[model samples]
Target: MKHEFDSAFHPADIAFKTLKLAPHAWVPNNSRLPVLIYRRAVDPSTKDLGKTFEALLAGNEWLPQWRDSIFDYHHFHSTAHEALAVISGKAEVIVGGPGGEVVSVAAGDVVLLPAGTGHCLQSTEGRFQVVGAYPEGQQWDIRRDALLKEEIAAMEALPFPRSDPVAGRKGPLLQEWT
Candidate 1:
């Protein structure tokens, strides 16, 4: 029996270029992470969190970062299942669980975390990149400070409403989410 491996197969090199040779650009401040927005180069139809339950369950993986910057949690998938494929770059994927290890996933490495896992990413040296997947019905939960900033900016941009709810206009509703 004979097996064949590509002559140019280097784990580090492979990781660095998996998502290379593709058109990439700087993400603007207003733009959220491409993964959560479904704007990355991958198949958007298949990447929806709600419909692609199997991918979420089976724990699909991919390059999670690129050559420039890491994806921001506020811009990435929120409250959804996820898997990661580390082709290159250096980073961490910390999920919530007992003995949840902060695995050092690098080139030719794979890791899977359960749904609703809080994610924070940072790049080492150059740009860090990885492939990732998530379940649907996900939302970006803004931090308390970030939410306050947005609310304040929004309020400053507009005149106060006639009903002034925040100004002690008690309504019939108790809690919104409930």
Candidate 2:
């Protein structure tokens, strides 16, 4: 669907929730990666939700991303924050760690994972697809439930992105994370 605010989309129009985390066995010691969820951010009637979501992220400076399905196992990125926008189908995702919370997400939903926040695809419907990306110039390091001391330190030292993947520099992402 088209919106009058499309040219001047305000962050206030979008409702976001944050998930705080503590250092787990596999995850490292650092500020709880802010988990921001934007529900129904896209219009269901819109075709090609994947490309649209990618464009939104890219516009906000979350670049060098990929389009694919989420892995059905627990994993975390110690080096960079990640954003996942559900383009099609539905799935249950575990966030924060193996014992983290399970969230049911579908098309038009967006999830922002801070560095070191563990996530996995618990279950999925027929065709689950997500568009994933990172902040400009950031590469991803995959880590399961294990980490070395230096790895933990590096994760703790990782910098927050200047802008939100979905929102811009003045979005809720910066407000909650920084």
* Whole-model Cα lDDT of every candidate shown, in order: 0.28, 0.78
Q: Which candidate is the best by lDDT?
A: 2
Candidate 1 weakest ten by summed lDDT: 14-23
Clashes of each: 15, 0
lDDT of 2 by residue, 2-63 (tens): 11112244334566677777877676524555688877777644699888888888988897
Best candidate (score: TM-score): 2
Candidate 1 error regions (>4 Å): 1-79, 97-101, 122-126, 135-178
- lDDT tens string, model 1, 50-138? 22322322232221221223344322222332445443455664322122223344443333332223344533533455555332333
